[model samples]
Target chain A: MSLTIAIPKGRLGTQAIEMLKSAGVGESIDEKSRKLVFKDENRNLNFILLKNSDVITYVENGIADMGISGKDMIMENSADIYERYKMNIGRCKMSVAGIKGKRVFNDDTIIKVATKFPETAKKYFNGKGQKIKIIKLNGSIELAPILGLSDVIVDIVETGNTLKANGLEVFEDMYNISAMIISNKISYKFKRKEIKEIIELIRKEDTE
Target chain B: MNFLNIEDEMKYFQKMFLLRKEIENYLYEEGYLNIEPSIFEGYDEFTGINSRINRKSTVKLLDNNSEILILAPDITTGIVNKFLPRWEYGKKLKIFYYGKTYKHNGIGIKENREMGVEIIGEKNQNTDQYILSTAKQIISRYSNDFLLEIGNSKFLKGIMQSCSFNKEEYDNVMNLLYSKNRQDLKDYLSNLPFKNAMSTLLNILDLEGTFDEIKEQVEGLYLNELMQQGVEELSKIDNYMKNITDKVTYDLSMVSELSYYDGIIFRGYIKGSNKEIIKGGRYDSFTEQYGYKIPAIGFTVELDELIKVLDKEEQR
Candidate 1:
C-alpha cells in the first residue's frame, strides 16, 4: 500500500511539492488541476492538497496519514498530532504591527486591534496590561491601521514588505514560523519504519 | 452497526463494571476505602473548582422548592463538599470512587465515567511522592510505554506573584508559556522591568532534559526562595520515582486544568497519543468552600481514553 501525505496549499505547497520530488517522489501535482488528490505511481505515494490550517486537523483526525503545516498554526489550534520533523522552510515571524510614527499607548484603553490571529493579538495586548477590542479580519490586516479601524495588527512578516508598504512597523515579534511535518498519532506508531525512512530521505535532501 | 444498540450497550456496561471492580480492588489494597455521595450538590460548592468548567458547562436545575442544584461535574468537589466532612474527624482519609460526572455540552465526556483516589489530610512532600509513585505503579501495570509528566503549578504561581502581575497579565503569560510560544514569552518579558528574572525563569521552563540534568541546571541559577523550594521538592519526587520506573519526567511549563491547584500536578500519557489518559494534582484550598480546611491530592483515569490507547497499541 502507498503512503498518503497531505501537502498544504498556497506558498508552503510549492516547497512541499519540491521536497517530495527531492525525496524521490516525483511531482504529479498539476498546477491547474482542480482535483485534490495526486498520485506518483513510481514512488507509491498519494498527495492530498489541503489548506494550511486544516493540515493538522486532517492528520490528527486520521483522515490523512501525514502532512506539513506551520508550527504557529499547530500552536494556535492546539491540535493533538505528532510532530514528526521540522521542514525548516516557509520561514516567517509572527509580529505585532502598528502604523509608523504613531505613539503606542501602554495604558488600559480599549485599543482596537485587528488580525486573523485573534488569540495572538489578544495575548500581546493583554500582557501589556491593556484591555483590547479585537477586530477580526481575513485579508489585508494592514488596512485596519490605514483605515483607522484598529490601533494595531498581528500578522506574519516574511520580508516586512507588505507592512512597510502600508506604513506599518513591527512593534513586537511573537514567534518564528516554519513548515513542520506531522503524522497521525496512530499512523506514526503503526507505520514507524516507513515514516522514519521518509524523514531520513527528506533530511538528507535538506542537508545537500 | 450502531454500538449504542441495547445488546452492545449491555456488553459495554458489563466491561465498565468489571473495570470499576478492578480499580476499587486495587485502591483497597493500597489502603483506600470506597466513598459515594449524592449526585447533586449546591451551586456554591463548585465555585472555582475547575477553570475549564465554567458556569456554562454546569448542568443547573431547580428542585421543587426552586433551589439551585447542579449535577456534579467533578468528583473532587463532591468529595470535598459532602463526603470528606462525614469522614472521621482528626484522622487521615484515603478514598477511592467510580462515578459519572455531568457537563452541559463541551469539556470532557458528556457524562464522564471516572475512577479515582483521593488522599486527604497531611500536607507534606512524602504524600506527594507516595501518590505519584502509586499512580505510576497502577498505570504501568496496565501499559508499559506510558509517560508520566510531573509539574509544579506552585512554581508558576510563585513566579507570577513575585512579578506582581495582574490577572490579565498572568493569564496571558500562562497562555503563551503553555503553548510553547517562545517568541511571545520573549516579547512579553521584554516589556517588563524584571526582564532578567523572567528570562531566567523562561529559560528554565524551556529546558527539557532528564530529572537530574534539569535539577543541575536549576541549581546554577539564582531563584527566589519559593522557586528554590519547589525545585527541591520536585527533585526529591523525581529521585524517588527514578528507582521505580523510567517512564516519569518533569515538565516545568505544564498548565493545569484547575487554577486552584497549589502544588504538583501530573498527567499520564501513553506514547503516540496526544490526549492525557490520567490527570490530577494537589489542591490544598479545594475544601475551603465546604467550611473546613484540608490538604488533598488525587487523580482520575479516563478509562475510555486508556482503552483507546491500548487498542491502538494492540493493532500496531
Candidate 2:
C-alpha cells in the first residue's frame, strides 16, 4: 500500500513538487499535465493534485495520507490534521489593509471587513475584543475597500504589491503564513516509519 | 444525492442499537453491573472534575438556594460520589453505564451516547490487559483495520519533572508535541535548557511501530526511574495484548487532560475515521476525589463514530 500525498495546484504546487523530488519521494510528477493523479511505483508513492483550498479536505477525510499547503489555508479551513513539518516555503503574511486615508474603525464603532478567509478574520478580531462584520469575497480582495463593499480587507500579502497598486496600506499584520506538511492522524499512527522517513528527508534537504 | 433519507436513518438507528447490545453483552459476560447515573448533577460536586478540562458545560441556575446545576459532564465523578464510600475496599466492583453525556463545544450543544465499563479496586498490568482485550474484541468485530495506539503519560511527565520546566515552557513544549509541529519543536528545543534531550525526546515522540520495534527504540535511550517503569509496564501489557490482537502499536507522545489517568492510556482508530472509536486507560487517581483510595481502569466506545465509519465503509 503506497502512501498518498495531496498537493495543491497553484503557485505553491510547483515548489511542493520540487521539494518532494529533492527529498527523493516523488520523482515522476509531470510538470505540465492535466491529469490529477501521479504515481511513483519504485518509491510506492501517489500524488494527487487538487485546488489549494481542497488539499486539507482530502487529508482530513483520510483519502490522502499527507498534504502540503500554505498555513493560510490551514487557518482558513480550520483544519484539524496534524502538522508534521514546516517546509518554510511559500512564506507570506495575513494582514489587514485599507485605503491610505481611510479610518473606518473607531473606539465604539463596528468594523466591516472583507476577505476570503472569514474564519481567520473572525478569530483575529475576537481575540482583540473587537466586533466585526465580515464580507466574504472569493478573489480580488483589494477591490472590496476600493468599491466600498468593506472598510478593510483581510487577506494574504506576499509582497504588498497588489495592496500598493490599489492605494491600500497594511493596518495590521495578523499571522505569518508558510507552506507546511500535514498528515492525517490515523495515517501517522499506522504509517509512522514511512511518514517519519519522508519528513526527515525533507527536513534534511531543507537544512542544505 | 438524498441517499440518507428516512430508510437509511432508521437503519442507522437500528445498527446503533445493535452495536450497543453487543457492548452490553460483553460487559454482562465480564460480570459488570449495569448502573445508570443521573443526567443532572450539582455544580459544586461536579466542578472538581469539570474545571480540570477547559470545556464548558450547560449550566442552569437554581434560584431557590442560589446553587448552580450542571448537565453532568462526567459519569465517573457521579458514580464515585454516590457509591464508592459504601463499597468495601480491596473488593473489585465492575460497573457498566450507558447514557448521553452533554457538552457545549462553543458551536452548539451536542449530546453523545457513551457505553463504558469501570473497574474499581484493582490497577495492575493484568487489569489493563483485561480491559484492553475486551475492547479489542468488540472493536475487531466491527472493523478489521482498527489500530490501538497505547501510551504512558508518565513517559513525558518523567521527562518534564527531570527538566524542571516552568509552567509556560512546559505548556509550549506539550502544545508543540500535541500539534506534532516537528520543526518548531526543533527550534524551541535549541534555545531551551534541555537542548541535549531534544533528540531523545523527538525519537520517542515519533516512535510508533510494532511492539518489538518500539521496545527496541525505547531501550536504546537513557531513561530515568519513572520512564523505565513506564516502559516496563507497557512492554508487559504489550506481551499480553499480542496474544489477543496484532493491531497494536506504541506512541509515547499521546497524552490526555484526563489527569485521573495515572498510568496507561490508549486510543483506537480505524483506517478512515477521523476520531478515535474507543478510549480507555488506568485512572487510579480518580477514586481519590470521592475520599477513597481505589484503583480503577475502564474504557468507552463512541458508537456515533463507529456508525459513521461503518456508513462510510458501506458507501465504498
* Number of the top-ranking candidate, with lDDT as the measure: 2
lDDT scores in order: 0.75, 0.80
Model no. 1, DockQ: 0.14
lDDT of 1 by residue, A1-208 (tens): 4677888888788876777687777467864689899888876778899988888888877777788889778866766666656666888999888999784656556778888888766756666778888899999899999999989888889999998988889987887787777777555544555766777777776653
Residue B233, candidate 2: Cα error in Å is 1.9
Candidate 1 lDDT, B162-188, residue by residue in tens: 778777677778766654555557667
CA lDDT of B145 in candidate 1?
75
Chain B TM-score, candidates in order: 0.88, 0.88
Error of 1 at A81 (Å): 7.4
Question: TM-score for each prediction?
Answer: 0.70, 0.84
Clashes of 2: 0
Segments of candidate 2 deviating more than 4 angstroms: A21-32, A41-44, A96-115, A121-138, A143-154, A167-173, A200-208, B1-10, B41-74, B84-88, B104-109, B162-170, B189-203, B219-224, B257-259, B308-316
DockQ of every candidate structure: 0.14, 0.61
Tens digits of per-residue lDDT, candidate 2, B115-188, equal: 87788887766788888887888789889999998888777767777767787788778777776777777777
